[model samples]
Target: MNLSIDVTNNEGVSNVVLTGEVDAFTAPKLKDTLLPLTKEKGQVVEVDFQDVNYMDSTGLGVFISALKSTKEHASTMRLVHMQDRVYRLFKITGLTEIINIESTVQGGM
Candidate 1:
């Protein structure tokens, strides 16, 4: 799986834009990239999936693990711009309620 990550730091928030497939082979990579960003004090991490084309359970696991790690470090993590299929996956897995998923970057409101 091919994965690309672009991280933007803004006002204590880390916007991570993810593109490409996130599967077992690539989930760890995503985790590694997100873990450190979420460890910073007062850091709010947002994983943007607007460009993602595919994902699997491992991808969901990556998000869950990131959320757990972020909470441990007193940081926040959220999902943004998920495609319809990705959103359905979250809904089917009941992760939509467990994680912070926004339709847009503006708090999904």
Candidate 2:
């Protein structure tokens, strides 16, 4: 399926829900949606990957860039509700150590 991104801002946080595959083509769209949010100071960006089926290296790059942008702005970015397959990708890549992942809805990143 093609990638789809849904964004919502509430209580100083930007919640991004991603559906479908994230590859080189779709990563750019994710980046564009996240870049401006990350630039906002004190804004917490939560990426929900519950609906995502697959992601490639370019997708990973988008998250990394968002993380960096958040840090630079004194904001934060988090991954939420990742599927096991996608979670494994980050774990194997050592991104789990650097990025916050919330496995449960109540789990704080």
Question: Per-residue CA lDDT of candidate 1, range 1-109, in tens?
Answer: 5999999999999999998988888889898898898888779998899998789998998888888888889999989898777788888999889899975344455
Tell me the spans in candidate 1 whose CA falls farther than 4 Å from its real position: 104-109
Error of 2 at 39 (Å): 0.5
Top TM-score prediction, candidate number = 2
Clashing residue pairs, backbone N/CA/C < 3 A, model 1 = none
Cα lDDT listed for each candidate: 0.86, 0.88
TM-score of 2: 0.91
Q: Candidate 2: which pairs clash?
A: none
Per-candidate TM-score against the hidden true structure: 0.88, 0.91
